[model samples]
Target: MFKEQVLGLMDQAELQIEGKRKEIDRIVDRNQWKVIRAFQKHKVSDYHFAGSTGYGYNDRGREVLDLVYADIFGAETALVRPHFVSGTHTIGTALFGVLRPGDELLMITGRPYDTLHKVIGKPGDGLGSLQDFGIRYGEVALLDDGSPDYESIARCISSSTRVIGIQRSRGYSWRPSFTVAQIAEMVRFVKEIKPDVIVFVDNCYGEFTELTEPTEAGVDLMAGSLIKNPGGGLAATGGYIVGKAKYVELASYRLTAPGIGGEVGAMLGTTRSIYQGLFLAPHLVGQAVKGSVFAASVFERLGFVTHPRWDDPRTDLIQAIRFSGPEHLIAFVQGIQQAAAVDSHVVPEPWDMPGYEHPVIMAAGTFIQGGSLELSADAPIREPYIAYMQGGLTYSHCKMGVLTAIQNMIDRGLLHLEDN
Candidate 1:
């Protein structure tokens, strides 16, 4: 009975997503070519191998990896480090390293990833945060149509505004992720207002989903987590900041300290894995994107509201589905957990996860802890009760996960396949 029902749903999802297969293939091939070109251009040789403990500053493999990433992303310099921690941490470093006291930082996008909220800080709220450092902050909410409010941005920009921050991914928001082209337009607009204003993109789950990166589109600097799209489901831990030489240098200084910028951090025997992960990132991202499309189609067919509908142009790996209420939301998340390769027997529930405003449920059963490159799903406990699902190393695994989620919903009576 399980096989029959799940297979039937899978068949439906396949048909629904068939129209996007060609587009997905085109993107995959183009990105794969980019990766190959980067490797060839950098002359990735055997000498670029990692040593045990990896304590020296002369790791050719680490240098080559940085070079390859910079070349691939069209940045003047790049810093890939295991020491920087999460995406939020990397972004924090970039912000703090560049902006000084009395300088202003403008966030044109709506509220960024939940974790960044604490970093931005509230007036008289967070200690040692941007606000606490005397770095002023301002934000302009997206218009109802989900587009940037240019007028609001214009009104908000101050002479003290030294940086314009853009988040490429939607984060936990319901808005659509911005495409490379969209980011390019934003760069142009911001530059017109203040030519020297630094434009930085928080490129978390948005890497490699398109042919070009935000840096290529005139972004001054960008940061992302190794556990997310760029890691290719292989890197154990790390983060990357790639862009203009000066900005990257400053971030490196903040990551380590003044004068030690970008020179001393060791790869700690993970250079080979990081290199291998980048090599595989393009294809792995494509597979994850395919899974997102499949998820959108399957859920939309089941009468749930979906962001970036299956046929919509995908700019990132996330696929969001709105549930009827908390029950349906919890069930869906538990469903994803049940589908995981690791901890399939463990049940997830909402809890006060630090750095977030509300309780959150996460289904992250990855071999590498918190690796978004592997299959996972998570959602904050809140209104509209939407779950943000992303990642699957293989399309087949993603497909199975969708089926498992559907089966779970069916079992819980939140969904009735027969009724559908």
Candidate 2:
């Protein structure tokens, strides 16, 4: 019955979507080869499969993982650690490690993710925030058309600018995330303006979603959480920072201490999972991307506005759907939560979640606890009622989740398929 309903909803557009799926399959094949080549080049061996216990110095597994990440990202070094709490933590470490008192951190890509606001704090406020330590923050808003204002960026650059930040994913934002080619252009423009300034990218949900990465585009430093795209739904917890040798070293020092720096952190039996996750990441990311495409096509046909449409080039896994009202948004999230493999019984509601500017409703019924790599849906209680849905370990699971969301909305009278 559900399949019939889904088919009826598709209404003869199956062939077109299938063509797009074929293109996604080709992208997956190409990305899989890239991951394989990086693994082969690093000479991954059985010795690298072992995990480290205490004070994980000179651990072969850890060393090889770092090398694999660096090679994949075209970076001089990489620090992949399960110790880092979240993407926000990893990003904060990188910023604090590189910038100094009285230095400036300019975000060229407009406002950052809500979580980063605390890290960049109000001046003279939080003791641990960059602003408290005398670091200044500024952002050049994207133009009305969602394109970066290059003129504003050029004007913002100054002698005190230490790092030019870019968020590769559109975190909790309505705009489309920047593609790797676009990020590369930003890198070139920023470096041309201030050759010494570090170019840092918050590569959260953007990893392995495309043929290239921000690091490959000449970014000086980049960070991502293991619970996002790179984890492949396997890693329980972790984050990574990869970049120029000097900057990575500095970030590692910030992760640990000045002298210790990426040497003493133990894997705690997570080495195998991290390695296996990276190995599986390309294929899993492809699955998630296919799911996003499917969701976009299906939702668009239902008369809802979708970002990047079905045939658009995808640089990230997120698929945003603008609902008619908050009722539709809440119902959609509730449907996704009901379809979850974990914590499905509990219903989510709008709450003042930490690090968010408004009440946020999140359907993160993931095994890893906030694992965006698993199927999830969330939205802030704000305008346009757009819900950000991302991740699916398998394409079938994502399809089911999307269908369930539509069905739930229909049942609640928030959406009417027949009317559309």
Candidate 3:
């Protein structure tokens, strides 16, 4: 069973979203053309990923990327750049952005994303980890079996707190997800305890998970990527951080000039792709969510433990599955890819990379493991645990990916139809 305990509150949650949607509709109905014209002005950014802005110049592409990102995330200020390669990098930049010589960052989530352990702790690549950067750090914890312990967060709050980072969704954790309302509750809790502490959200796959963003939930800074939800499976690259204007100005400098200003320079052609993706995102996010639902049902029927069901959702559109071993993990990725691609153009394989505390393997057909259009499925390369994580652009695509994997099992006479 895909474990979700908040079902009792489903009715109330639905009502809240419906009201927000209606409000948004009313605003749209009143300014329909104005919205249309604003979107039309958004131009897609172009990149080759081969060189400096891919333009044969020492040009600054990140500045332009930010302008488009500000429009994308509904923030007072934003910055976008290819240099912010992964979701973690974007977060590291944001945290380092606001921390000063004497302040500290209190991480509300107990164990952060695995790879980030070093990035924030001492022994990491740079001179000082999150702690060494003049920002002392501490962690609020999770209860057993994975749930936020808000009281722990409150007890940890102190006068030296410069920033409080809240990871709103379940990433690689065994933890259950939180709704925007719950996220809002946490934000409010933090604010009541310390009004000036910056509330940052690692808003990875949770962009439209509920109906509103963390900005509406009172987050000071939020980060996500173009390769995920808001990118609409269209943007070729980038990450965005949006929030208060002054912090934004500081973060922008951290991203580029270290302590200078936000408008450092510009990317040659980033304006168009970011614009197009943001314009198309609302519809596309809906499509991806539908695929996620389908995936949850299909796998749940296979007797595998699924994190979410067709109707059960945690964060955004990710569909997570658990397999037994490394062999199964590799086999599963290969099976899904063999079934997903056009003539099976891309093959799935297992691999490991640096910076990750664990040995990670992924289905490579994906542009990026967590962000690709192909029906790519992946599980970590670990013993006794291989959690398959998959997402897609359309229902048909997701359906094919899972079905093909099932078909491969069937074709090998691995199982009989009568068994079902």
Q: Candidate 1: misplaced stretches above 4 Å?
A: 1-3, 52-55, 123-126
Better of 1 and 3 by lDDT: 1
**How well does candidate 1 match the true structure in TM-score terms?**
0.97
Clash counts per candidate, in order, are 0, 0, 12
Per-residue lDDT over 1-420 for candidate 1, one digit per residue giving the tens place of the 0 to 100 score: 355866876788898788797788888899889988999998998778655344457777878888999998999999998887898999999999899989998999987888998998966665789988888998889999888999999888889999999998888888999999999999999899999999999999999899899999999999999999888888899999999999999999999889988777677778778888888999999999999999998888888899989999999999999988998888888888888888899999999998999999999888899898788999998998999999999998888788888888888877886777
TM-scores, one per candidate: 0.97, 0.97, 0.80
User: Of models 2 and 3, which has the larger TM-score?
Assistant: 2
User: Per-prediction RMSD in angstroms?
Assistant: 1.3, 1.3, 7.1
Q: Please, what are the lDDT tens digits per residue for candidate 3 over residues 138-250? A: 88888885666887888888999888878866666656666777778888988999998899888877765455677766888988877877676767777778987888777
